[model samples]
Target: MADEGRRDRCLAAHEAPPVPPEGPVTTRLPRRSFARSATEVAPELLGHILARRLPDGVVLRARIVETEAYDQNDPASHAYRGRTPRVRVMFGPPGHLYVYFTYGMHHCMNVVTGPVGTASAVLLRAAQPLEGMERMSIRRRTDRVRDLCRGPARLAQAFDVDRSLDGADLVRGSEIWIERGPGASAASIRRGPRVGIRVGTDLPWRFWIDGPWVSVSRPAAVLSPR
Candidate 1:
C-alpha cells in the first residue's frame, strides 16, 4: 500500500496535478473558471483562499480579503511596460504564482491570469483560517484568530511563503495553491478602493471580509470593481 501510494503520487505529479495534503486534502468546494482576465482578477481575488501545506502535516489556509491588480501598461505595476528578471513570471501562461517584496519587509503573492504575454495578476488580499489553526497561531506569534492571516504579507508569513514561491505553479505546487471557500458571507465581502498605491486609488480593486478582525486595512472607499 505504501508503494502504491508513492506510485499514485508520482503519477499525479506526472500529470501535473496539485499535490493534495495528507489525509483528504480536497476541500470539495466550488471551483471557478479563470474567466476574468488578469486585469479584473486584482479585485476578484479578494474573497478567495490561498493554501499551502507544510512539511509537518499542517496545511495553512487564508481567506483573501484585499487585492490590487497589475496590468503591463499600468505604471503602478512592477513590470510597467517592460520585462524584468522579476516580473517575467507575470507574463504568463496563467495559473502561475508571482511573488515580490514590498517596503523591504513583506512578501506579497499574486496569481497570474489572462492569456500569455499579457502581464496581468490578481493580488491576494485576505483569508479566514479554515484549517490548521494551531499552526497559523504559532507562525503569527499570536493565538488571535483574527490576526493570523489578516493581510497580504501576514498571509505569506503565516504560510512561510517567500521568494521560493515566486514562480511556483499555483494550480499544482505542493507548497502553494488557492482553494475556494464558503467565502465571506455575502454581507461579509466588503469592497473598496485600493491601498498603498501612489496613483490609481480610484480603481476600487480591494476586497476584504466584512465585520471581522481579519481585515488588516479597510477599503478607504466602499465600492466594487467597475
Candidate 2:
C-alpha cells in the first residue's frame, strides 16, 4: 500500500493539459525506420505518437516519452540466450509489436528493431495521453489524465494491449501504428540505465525526454546531448 501511495503521488505531480480538439495530422513511420539497431531507434521514438485502433472504432493515441533499447547480444535481452518460441517475433522483421507478459500481471510492449533474423527491440516505457482520454481513463481506472499512461504496463492497460497484439505489424497494420510527431530535441533527451533489469545495469541504453510525463524518476547519471 505504501508503494501504491507513492505511485499515486508521483502521478499526481503533473497536471494534464487540456485534451486537444484533434490529434496531430502526421504520417506513420516507414518500416525502414525501425530496421536499424534498438539503441538507435529508442531515443528517436521519443515524442512520436503511438496509435491504437480499437474494435469499437475508437482510436487511442499517446506520445511516447521514454524508451529502453535491447539487443540479442545484450545480457538483459530476452533473446540473449538464443532463439526460442517466446522470442521468435523478436527475430522477425522490424516495425512489429512485441508484447510480452511480465510479473504474471502486466503486459509490456516493444517495437521490433534491427534487420530480419536479428533480435533487437525498443521497450516503450511511457507515453502521454493524447486522443481518447475518456476511454483511457476508464481503462486505467483513474481520472487523473497524467496517470493514464505513465508507465509501460499502465500504457498497455490503458490501450488494452495484451498478448493478442503480439507480432502486430506497426508499419502496415491498421490496428496499431506509430505516427510522426514533433520529436524531442536532442538537448532535451536524456540517457540512463534501463529500469528493472539485473543485467546490463551499467549500459546507458534508456532514453527519455526530460519531462514530467517520463515514467521513472530522473537518474543521477544522465548521459545526454547525443
Predicted structure with the largest TM-score when compared to the true one:
2
| Residue 170 Cα positional deviation in candidate 2, in Å, after optimal superposition | 0.4
Against the true structure, candidate 2 reaches a TM-score of 0.86
User: Candidate 2: what lDDT?
Assistant: 0.84
lDDT of 1 by residue, 75-190 (tens): 67787858888898888667777888888788888888777788877777557777787888887799888877777777777777666567776655666777765544445455
Lowest-scoring 10 consecutive residues by lDDT in candidate 1?
A: 27-36
RMSD (Å) per prediction:
6.1, 9.5
Count of residue pairs whose backbone atoms collide, per candidate: 8, 0
Please report, in order, the local distance difference test score of every candidate based on alpha carbons.
0.66, 0.84
Alpha-carbon deviation at 137 in model 2, angstroms: 0.8
Which clashing pairs does model 2 show? none
Q: 94-169, model 2: which lDDT tens digit per residue?
A: 9999988999899999999999999999999999889999999998899998888988999999998877677877
